[model samples]
Target: LPRRGADTPSLAAKRGKIARFYLAHASRANNWDLVDLSAPYIIGRWLLYPDADGKLPDRGILDTLASHSDLWHQRIGIVATLALIRQGQTADTLRIATRLLDHRHDLIHKATGWMLREVGKKDPGCLLEYLESHFRDMPRTALRYAIERLPEPQRLYWLKRQ
Candidate 1:
């Protein structure tokens, strides 16, 4: 239900309002497809850039979504980091991945691993270190996804460590 192209002069302000509205009604984003389609473009884009006043946006919302009890919200939180990963900003993605690493839901595990795989694409060292530190404890689905692009020996090593 998010609208596009505000006539208002302040582009940031227009997008800000729309992003806020999206969060207010985020519960309606009932399905994974709805979330994957929208969170990156709206929440991710909104937080990635500075505001109209030019201050860095607070990223606490990412933590909030990651820690929330709602499954879809948690999925949104991890998936939203896709935008940041695309821009080579993997810090937020890693942080959220850590938060959701032990999540019980298969979907959250998939999202976290998918985002980490993206981080690997952008920065392989970061992803390797993260795997080295947590491979033993991380979920198999996530481990498989994160190491999908690594060389065969490295992938086998991480998988064997589990």
Candidate 2:
């Protein structure tokens, strides 16, 4: 189980250690929920947290995990972005969605599509732009999921593109 707060003075350092420990034991995070809950709190937060200098951390970790062979880890890469998404950050979700577009697993397709739909919820224009480029090639499951919340006419447009 992850502790909420460790030591305030060394919060960042301790969180980094905790994130590393959880990631090192990622194999134990076998299911989608586990990965979803843990990634944002640990891995995602660790990588995205700003330091005292106000410099944000790099997001390469998500890209690496997104391309990992293990299904659970791959799911974690996308699902973790939910944290950023809720905070109105959509760029990471879009980038990760692009990388996972060709993945064959239904679970990966679902996760990617879910995130894309969420991005749409926050920024409809962004989702429209993404679908314009990739809707034709998107897996049926993903495409359907991505357009699930669109108005009927708009949803029909993307469905027709398939």
Candidate 3:
């Protein structure tokens, strides 16, 4: 929610300005807390909803972030999916999560797994279906985070798949 009921372009402009600043300084603000705090509410939310002009959200920005060599940028991209998850919009999260499944960093793994867990909260079948297909290749930390909410038996089943 940028401005609740109002489609004020000034706020939109401000948001854009903030995004630009972040894009430039993401490396300096490489701390996990900083990325987690802002990317979701600002970047991710912008990707899911129309602004004042009623323009459709552009997902290409996410693709850019995901494909970047910077770890924080990639984390920002995956964690930004939190906005979609909150709105019962898990598709983007799922799509982005898949792209980072084989990532080498634990931060990406935890973020991906956390997003997957959130997706399970909204749609268990969706998460289960994904895990069923990719659990073996998934990192142990990620698999643990992703299956944290499942039943004991189901959790065991997924973990054993490793």
- Quantify all predictions' global Cα lDDT against the true fold: 0.86, 0.82, 0.84
Estimate the lDDT of model 2: 0.82
- Superposed by TM-score, candidate 3 places the C-alpha of residue 49 at a distance from the truth, in angstroms, of 2.7
Worst 10 residues of 1 by lDDT: 1-10
lDDT at 138, model 3: 88
Write one digit per residue (lDDT tens) for candidate 2, span 1-162: 224753243566666668778878888889877886787777766666653344565787789889888998898889889778877888898999999988999988998899899999999999999999998778999999999999999989889879
Residue-level lDDT tens digits of model 1 in 49-106: 6667776568899999888888998988989989888988988998899988788988
Higher-scoring candidate on TM-score, 1 or 2:
1
Cα lDDT tens digits for candidate 3, 1-162: 454687567766666667767778878758789999989987876776565576756887887888899999999988898988988988788888878888999999998999999999999999999898888788998899999999999999888778
TM-scores of the candidates in the order shown: 0.91, 0.87, 0.91
Sort the predicted structures by lDDT, highest score first: 1, 3, 2
* Best model per lDDT: 1
